[model samples]
Target: MDRKLQRSWMMYDWANSAFATTIMAAVFPIFYNSVAANNLSEGTATSYYSFTQSVAVLIVATMAPVLGAIADYSGAKMKFLRFFAFMGMAGSVLLFTVNEGDYLLASILFILASVGFSGGNVFYDAFLPHVAKNEEMDRISTKAYAFGYIGGGILLAINLVMIMKYDWFGFPSSKEATQVAFVTVGIWWFIFSIPLFKNLKEKKVGDPTEKRDKSYIAIGFSRIGETFKTLKYYKQLLIFIIAFWMFSDGISTIIRMATFYGSTIGIGTNDLIAALLITQFVGIPCTLFFSKLAKWISAKKALTLALAVYVVIVILGYFMTSALHFYLLAVCVGTVQGGAQALSRSIFARMIPHNKHAEFFGFYGITSKFAAIIGPAVFGITAGLTGNSRLGILSLIVFFIIGIVLLQLVNIEKGEREAKALEDPREFVKVEVK
Candidate 1:
């Protein structure tokens, strides 16, 4: 791809991250608990939040792979991206209207936004091979993540300012001003996505001879079935997928529940926002640094290092009794969060057949969504049963340990070789035609 197109594609990271920052990381949950669920008891509010997020994951997990397969078959990646982006943005903007004592409405909007956010990522990951070469993918993926942290941090910082100085914004209260911040996230997501839509070319569909004989829906199910059966053939890729599933479960749970956990433990709203802001900016440089580290050490080893950091952070979080400790833990998490996730994407990209990028990335999406379900459900259950949120937080350590054990077993080089061999014949045929 040309430099302009590559940059345009990366900008989608900048565009969509505002949703993750304002809605997911900083504002929505806090506002929902304090205002939307003002009539509900504390336990009920927490349970509702957990249930809403889990439901979104369940819906996306079932649909994402099929959607991805269809997009690949029809060469409709950008079209699907636009559709889901609109859904997410509309859902985000709806949050602006959610006032106190509107718990049901708020929950529904959040579920819509969460679905949009998670679903959009499937197409976003599909664009990787189009924008960068094999050697450059790790760096490009990491840079996109770094940009995401910066973009998310910048928006969150502005929202924090609005919340802290509600009178300046002409809002009646901080809560009301926070509610308006959701609209900004929606607008930001829509406006930034324009460059990607304008500049990035959709992947060209293969000739009819290369196209699958079945209908897209039929091919989708068959591909999924084949993927499961073929799992035994791709030992290294399967092992790595399991490892990613394990660690990502822990990571997703932490992202979803951290703010709520802090609120429950007496951490002030300002403190929670500040801690997340710290993570956002801190993640930028660390993401870039990990890209460099991958050049020296393998991507898998670099991921292992990040997981080790996660173990330490989760362990420390378990012992956190004060706001200061929470702030410290947030910083630690920010340092590794973007880097680990970026490397994970690049590592998987290296292992998958290039022609089937979107199809395989669909499976990646499914695994991530499913993994999300387990950790949060476990966290919610443990928190409810024990009445100690710290214990729930601490349980994440098991995920990291198991993920690392599984990761160590994956043969990265072997998987890359296998993927290359599968694509080499097709590439040679293309060259002959040219």
Candidate 2:
């Protein structure tokens, strides 16, 4: 394995995670509420934020797979990654100009930034199979998640301090500090990303001698059609994707809506923020521990164990009535969040052909975004009908249960064998038109 290349790949996670933490998770929502939506009620501000999030996810989910196919056909994975990264960075930098009553501008920039973040990740994930050998996938993936935790945590802590000590920085208020933090995130993301662009290379796909006249875009659409028609032959992989979609939806719902739920149950904003920080820092060691655990017990079993824990957490969430309970739930989620996700990526990496990683991981990205839709939608519907957030939290358990059931049916070894059998992996399977 090329250690330097592996390190470079991991650094991209470290780089982009600042956007995850500082922009998406912490500073931006609060800034949008206080500054951008100054003319609106708190509830209205939150609704606008949710609207922006949904729009961004919708755009990326629709684009990921097509772009992935195009990247594979054109050998332009790096080019796509660069374009998205710049889009995200420019959006983040532009956020510094947002002021009171600028909700429209804020939402637009956020959507662009989010599209960049989510879109860039499609290519980043595609590089995994290229950068790490089959045996090394677990370790490399977990290490990247760990780096994300550490890097994101450090920057978030700094941003927090800057907000709290705005006076020391000659800022009149926390709002100014928050705006500066947005600019800082853009700089941090861009600087750390330089290594990946400099060091990592996209693996070529398809036979060089097999020439076709199809334009890259045309081939991209054709590949998507081919992939859909051939799904029947790859039963295990298809089942795994379904199971992953369900459980990942549950996970994403919990992450996205946890704080809001906590507030409804009487947890203070400070407590909620602190609890999330705990999840971030706690995830660092736990993610690395899962790497070792996967090596000892296999990725499938480790993931199963994580999903089982999630079932317990959601059930407990139904009964949680105190700040301490919320904190405990946060810890439980922290223990498995990074580990489960990292292992899932590695396991999927091992089951797919290296040549089609870009295309397949594009599907992976779409499933992830789709999950973002499912969990939240279910939770919202349940909460609206029952008038209780606990029941809404409990509804997520259904996703975990169904995911576990489907995951049990997947034969990882068999799937790996089938995927490995394809010499021209880009073919996936032969397409037949009726």
Candidate 3:
């Protein structure tokens, strides 16, 4: 890909990530549970929130594989991206329409938006191979994530100011300002995606071979079946997937539950949002630093280091009894969060067959969605059973440990050789079809 196109593609991360920072990670959940569901009891609101998030993950997990297969088969990744992007933006815009007592409406819209956000990532990740070479991928992927953190942080900072300084804008309270922030995320997401549509080439689908005898949907299901059947053949990939599923579960749990945990510990809302904003910005430089670190240390070792940091963070959470401690922990998490995730994506992309990028990334999406489900479910359940939410937070250490152990078993050189063999120019053709 040309430099312009690569930059354009990366900018999409800048565009869509505001939603993750402001709405999903930082502000909107608290707004929904506290302001939108103000009429409901605390337990009921928490239950509704958890249920909605789980439903969204379930839908994504069920559909992502098929959706990815179709994108690969059709060679219409950008088209699929546009479809999901619209869904996400539209759902976000609908958030502004939610009233204080409209908990169910808010929950449903949030679920829709979450599905769109996660689903869009499947196609977005598939673009990595198209845009970058193996040598450049880790840096490019990490840079995109770094840009995402900056973008998300910038928006969250502005939103935080808006909410904090509501009286200056003639808004009656922080809640009203927060409603406006939801609208801004929708607008931001929609506006930033335009560059990708304009600049990137649509990947061309190959002409069907004479032996290819299935309808597209049939091919999709067959491919999915093949993927599962061949899982054992790719031992390193399978192991990495399991490791990603486990460790990312812990990461997702911490992100999704952080606000609630802060509230449970009597931290103020503004303080929690401020801490999250700090993480977003802090993640920017750290992401870039870790990308460079990957060149000196292996990506796997770097990720292991990040997971070690997570273990420390989880341990610290057990001892945190004050807002200052939460702030300190947030800074530590910010340093590793973006870098760890970016390296994971790049590493997995390195292992998979580029010809079937979307199909494999679809499986990647499935693991991510399923992992999201597992983390929150386990955290919520353990928190309920123990009547001590911090205990649930601490339980995440086990996931990090397991993931690190599994990661060590993967032979990176072997995985690279297999991918390169699949990509041998003499063995492949780029036949274009109408």
Candidate with the greatest lDDT versus the true structure: 2
TM-score: model 1 vs. ground truth: 0.93
Q: How much is 59 displaced in model 2, in angstroms?
A: 0.6
By summed lDDT, which 10 consecutive residues of candidate 1 come out lowest? 425-434
lDDT values for all models: 0.85, 0.89, 0.85
- Can you write out model 2's per-residue Cα lDDT over 197-309, one digit (the tens) per residue? 99987656666678879887788888788777666666678899999999999999998989888989999988888888899999999999999999999888999999999
Better of 1 and 3 by TM-score: 3
Model 1: how far residue 385 lies from native, Å: 4.8
lDDT of 2 at 256: 90
Global Cα RMSD, each model: 3.7, 2.3, 4.0
lDDT, candidate 3, 1-434, per-residue tens? 48887888888899899889888887788787778899999889888887888898889889888888878878878888888988999899889888888999999999889888988989999999889888888888999999899878888888888888999888999888988999999899888888888988875666656355678788889878866765555567888999999999999888887877888889897788878877888899999999899989988899999999999999999888988998999899999999999999999999887767888899999888888888877887888899998898888888999999999998877776665554432332331111
In candidate 2, position 363 carries an lDDT of: 91
RMSD of candidate 2 to true structure, Å:
2.3
Q: How close is candidate 2 to the true structure, as a TM-score?
A: 0.96
lDDT of candidate 1 over 1-434, digit per residue (tens): 48888788888898899988988877787788899999999889978987887788888888888888778767888888888888999999999889889999999999998888888889989889889988988889999998888877888888878987989989999988887899889988998889898987775666756845688889877766655655555567788999999999999888877877888889987888888888899899999999999888978899999999999988888888899999899889988999899999998988887667777898899888888888987887888799988899988999999999999998888888777665543343232210
